[model samples]
Target: MIYNTLSGRIEEFKPLEEGVVKLYTCGPTVYDYAHIGNFRSYVAEDLLKRFLKFLGYRVIHVMNITDVDDKTIAGARAEGISLKGFTAKYEKAFFEDIETLRLDKADYYPKATEHVEDMIKIIQGLLEKGYAYEKEGSIYFRISSFPEYGKLSKIKKEELKAGIRIDADEYEKEDVRDFALWKAKKPGEPSWPAPFGEGRPGWHIECSAMSMKYLGPTIDIHARGVDNIFPHHENEIAQSEAYTGKQFVRYWFHVQHLIVNGEKMSKSKGNFYTLRDLLSMGFSPRAIRYLLLTTHYRKVLNFTFDALYQATASLKRITDFLFELETRNFSDGQTEEARNMIEKTKKDFTAALLDDLNISGAIAAIFEMIHWGNKAMEGEKLKKKDAEQIKLLFYDLDRVLAILPEKIIEELPDEIMELIKKREEARKNRDFATADAIRDELFKKGIILEDTKEGTRWKIIKT
Candidate 1:
C-alpha cells in the first residue's frame, strides 16, 4: 500500500494495466545547481521506482526538466546568455550529480521548451471547452468553470475567492483566482508563438502536456515535493482534468521538505548546500545516499554533519560484516535455519517498503539479519553455504537500498599478491617483525589486511 496524497490515506496500489506502471516524477528546474533538499525527493522517488521494478512491475518513468520557467528566464538574463545556453551548463551539472547519487535514469526526460506546441494544443482544447478564457495576448484557466480546483490542495474555494494570490503566479489575467495558461510576451524573456498569444506556456501546463504526450491522459503515479502540493500540482490537476474530462492521476506521492542543521535551509542564513559542497569536504556519496534513504519521505529530514558521519559508520559496519563473513572459515554442513531466516528477513524488508515505504522497519530488518549472522558465527554454527546465502540476500536488497559500496573487488596486482603470500609465510613461521613490515608496506600501497580464522584477506582501500 502507498499513501495517496489526494485521498490523505494509505491505499492499495493497482496499475491501469496489469504488470505495468506509468510513473511521473517532477525533476529539477535547471535554473541552478540542485541542493540536497531537492535530492531528498529524487532519492525517495528512485527508491519507489526501484522497489516497483523489484516487485516485477515494468515501470515507464518520466521526469520533466523545467528549463523554461521564470527562474530560468531570470537566470539567463542575469548571465547575459541565451536561455538554453545558460541552462545547459546547470542541466549538465544536475545529471552529473544524478550519476554521483546513483539514481536510476528515467525512461524519458521531457524538457518544457521542446514541447510548446503540445502545451498550446492543450490550452486550445481548454479554450474550446469553455474552461479557459483569452485576454489581450494571454490565456488563463477559469477557476470558476472548474469547481473542483482545490480538491488536492484542500484549499477552499472561499479562500481563493476571498482575494487571489497574484505575485505567486501571473497577474495579467481577469481574476486573481484564475491562473495563467499562456503568458504574454515580455521584452527580454523567451516567447513561443501560439494562436492565443506569443508567450511561453505557463509552468503548470508544461507537465500536463508532456506527461499526456508520453504517458496517457490518466497516469498511475505522480510524485513531487510537498511544497508542490499546492499551486503547482493543484494547477496541473485543474487544467489537466478539466481538459481531459477524466482523472489525471491515481497516486499522488509527495516528499516532505528537508531541513539542515535543525533549521530550514536558506541561502541567506548560510546553511544552503549542494551535493558538490558535501563531496568537496570529503564525505562519501554512499554515505550521503544512505542518510537520505533512512528517513521516511513523509517526514522532514534534519540533515547535519554529525548525522552524515554516523551514516558513514553505519555503512562501514555493514560492509565490515560482509567482508568478515566472506573471508572466515565455516563448517562443512549448511544451516537450514539460517537460510529460512534470510528469506524471512527479505520478506519483512519488502513488506515494510510496501507499507508506505517504511524505511525504519526495513532498516531494522537488515540489522536483525546482521545480528543473526554474527551470533551464528560466534557459535561456530554458520556454514559456508549459510554465509553465502546471507550475502546473496544483501546483494538483492541493495538493488533498492543502493547504500552499499558499488565497487566489486577485482584481481590484485602481482606485487600486492606476492606481498600477501609473504605475509602469510611470515605469520606461519612466527616471524613477527617481517609480517608487521609487510603489512605496513601494503597499507601504504592502498591495500588493507584483515587476518581471519581461515587466512589473511586483504581489501583494496577506496579513495
Candidate 2:
C-alpha cells in the first residue's frame, strides 16, 4: 500500500482531514478529439477514485478543462470559429469518449475560461509576494524566486532552459526560464480584463488556480500523465507552493504513457488512434478498457491489434463463465478452499492497487479467481448456493474492474421468438426430426442456439 511521492516513498497514509479526499487531475486541453493515450490517464484516475471509495474514503475529484490555451487559440483561428465554439466541440467529444470508457465522472469539471477571475487573483498574489514579475506585455513567474523549481521533476536548476514556451508566439521574454503567468493581450485571441491588462492566463497557471479555488491550497492527491511531470506539473508545483506557502498535494500519482511501436502517441506523430477509430474498426469499448486494465497503470502499455485481440478473448472467457454460473445451483455453506482463495485474492488485489495502483497484478488476481471458479464448477463440487456465492464474489471484484455481467438470456426478434417457441413445443412432443429442421433453418439466418439448464439462448453471429 506504499505510494511514491516526489518527496519520498510513504508507507502510511493519513488523510489531511478525516474521511475526506480532495483530488485534482489535470484534464485535457480541449482542442480536438482525445486519443487512446489520453484515455489511459483517465482510466488510471478512475481506478484510483474507485479504490479510494473501496477504502471508505469520501473523494471529491475535480478535473479542470483547459478550454483556452495556446492550442485552443490556434485551433479556433485555423477553423474560423469562436473560442467558445471550438472549445465546446472538443470538450463534448472528450466527455463522450471517457463516458464510453466508463470512467467515473469527476465531482467537478471546471473550465479555465470560467475561472479567469481566480487565475487573475492568484497572479496578483504572486505579484504582491514578489514571486512573479510583469514582462513586456505578459506576466511571468520568476523561476529564480522559487528555489525549489526543479524539485517535482527532479531536474537540476543549472540545467534548466529558459523561454521553453509551448505557444507559437513571436513575443520572447528576456529570460527564457521564466514561464508565463498571464499572456498580454493579442488580436484574434480570447482575453479577460484584469489589473495587469486585458490578457489570458497561462497553461500551467490555470490548474493551480482552479484546483486551489475548489479544493483548498493543499489537496490529497494530484494526478496526470507522466509526460506532464516536467514543465507542466513542475510549473504547477512551483506556482502553487509559492502562492500558498504550503504543500500543494500530498500524493502525486502519475500514469505512464501509452506507446505505439515504442513511440509515444501524439498528434505531432500522426500515428495516434482515437477511441472512435477503434470503434469504427469493430472493436468493443469494453475490450478496449480490458486491454488497458490488463497492464499496470505505471507501466508503459504498448498497444497493438494482437494485444487487443488477446484482451477480447480473455474478456469473452470471463463472460462465458459468468453466464454459466448464473444458471447453475449451489448449496449455501462455504467451502474452506473457496473461502480462503477469495480472501487471498481480495488481499492481493487490494495490495496491488494500493501500491501505486498496480492494475496488472490486480488483474492477475482476478484471473486466479476465474480459474478457481471454473474448477469448482467443472468438478460439480460447488453446490447451487455455493456457485451463487462465487458469482456474487465476482460482482464485488467487478466494482473496480467495471466489466458488465454477461447476459444469459439472449434477445430475440418476434419472428425468431415464434420459431424458438415452435421448436421447443416440437421437442416437448418428442418430434426430434422437426426440431432439428427448425434449428437448421434458424442457423442459416445467422443465429446460433444453445440450451442451458435454465432455458434456450441464441446469439446473432455477424458475418
Candidate 3:
C-alpha cells in the first residue's frame, strides 16, 4: 500500500503492468546546490523504489533535470555565462551529493532542454484539441476549457479569476490560472523554434512531456515533494489528462518537508543546510541517510545536532554487530531457534514495508533482531550457524536501509591498521601508557577503536 495524495488516503498499489512499475519523480532545477530539505524528497523516493523491488517489482524510474527554467536562466545571466555552463556546475555537484548518499541512479534523467520538441508536440495537440490558446506568441493551457481543472488541487475553478495569466515559469495566480505551455522568446534567454515560435518550455509542462515520452500516456506512480502538489503537479494533471483524455497517474506519492531546529528550512531563515555542509561538520553520509529515513516520509523531519549524533551512534552499533559476527566462529548447521527468529523478523519486515512503506516500523523490526542477536551472543545460545543467519539478515535489511559503513570503511588507510596492531601489541606487553597513547593518536586521526570479548575492532570516524 502507498499514500495517494490525489485520493487523500492510503491505497493498495497495483501496477499497470505486472511485475513492473513506471515511476516518475521531479528532480532538481540545477540552478544551485540542493539543500537537505530538497534531499528529504529524493531520499524518500529512493526508499520507495527499494521497497518496490524488495516486493518483487521491477521499477523503471525517470527523474527530470530542469536545466532550462527561469532560475537557471537568471543564474546563468548573473554569472555572465551560457545557461548550459552555469547549470553544469551545480548539476555536477547535485550528482556528487546523491552519490555520496548512495542513491541508486534512475533509469533516465531527462533534461528539459533536450525535450523541447516533445513539449511542442504536446502543446500542438492541446491547441488542436482547443484546450490551449496563444497569447503574444506564447501558448498557455486554457484552464477554463477543462472543467475538472482543480480536482487534484481541490481549488475550485470559480475561485480562479478568468483572463489572468502568470508568465513566469513558476507562480500562483489568484484568478483563472492559465499557465504557459510555451513562453515567447525573450532577449538573452535560451530559445527553441516550434510551430508556436521560438521560446522555451514552461516549468509545469516539462514533466508531463518528458514523463509521457518515456513512460507513455499514463504512469504507475508520480512521486514528488509536498510543495509540488499545488500549482506544479496539479497543473501537470490538467495538461496531460487534457491532452490524452486519460488518467495522468494512478498513484501520487508526496514526501513532506524537513524542519531544522523547530522551523521550516530556508536560506532567508539562516537554517539552510546542504549535504556537503553536513558532511563538513563531521556527519557521515550514511548517518545522514539513516536519519532521513527514520521518520515516515509524510511527516516533517526535524533535523538537529542531537539527531545527527544519535544517527552516528546508532550506525556504530550496527557496524559493531557486523564486526562481531564476521570474526566469531560459527558451525555448519543452521540453528532452528535462530532460524525461527530470523523468519519472524523477515515476515515483520515485509509487512511493515508493504503497508504503505512504514520504514520506521521496518527499522524497529531490525533493531528488535539486533537486540535479540546480541543477547544470543552473550548467552552462548548463538552458534556459528545462528551468527551466519543473523549476518545474512543484516545484509538483507541493509539492502533497504543502506546505512552500513562496511563498504565505506574498506577505503580507510592501511596506517589505521598498523596503529591498531601496535595498540594490540602494547596491550599484550602490559605497556598501558603506550596503548593509551596509540589509541589517542588513532582517535585524533578519526579512527575509533572498540575492544570486545571476541577481539579489538576499529572504525573510521566520519567526522
Sorted on TM-score, best first, the list reads 3, 1, 2
User: Model 2 lDDT vs. the true structure?
Assistant: 0.84
Provide the TM-score for each candidate, comma-separated: 0.93, 0.90, 0.94
Q: Which parts of model 1 have CA positions greater than 4 angstroms off? A: 161-165, 168-170, 408-448, 460-463
Q: Residue 309's C-alpha lDDT in candidate 1?
A: 89
Best by TM-score: 3
Residues 1-463 of candidate 1: C-alpha lDDT, one tens digit per residue: 9999999999999999999999999889999899999999999999999999989999999999999988999999998999999889999999999999999999999999999999999999999999999887889999889989889989986677664446634566667778888988988889999888699888899999999999999999999999999889999999999989989999999999899988999999999999999999988898999999899999999999999989888887788778767778787878788988999999999999999999999989999999888888889889998988888899999999988776545479897899889989999999989999999998998788988676777777542
The 10 consecutive residues of candidate 2 with the worst lDDT sum are 162-171
| Cα RMSD for predicted model 1 | 2.5
All candidates in order of lDDT, best leading: 1, 3, 2
Winner by TM-score between candidate 3 and candidate 1: 3
- In candidate 1, the residue pairs with backbone N, CA or C atoms under 3 Å apart (3 or more residues apart, or in different chains) clash, namely none
RMSD vs true structure, all candidates: 2.5, 3.1, 2.6
Q: How close is candidate 2 to the true structure, as a TM-score?
A: 0.90
- The local lDDT score (0 to 100) that residue 195 gets in candidate 2 is 97
Regions more than 4 Å wrong, model 3: 162-176, 408-422
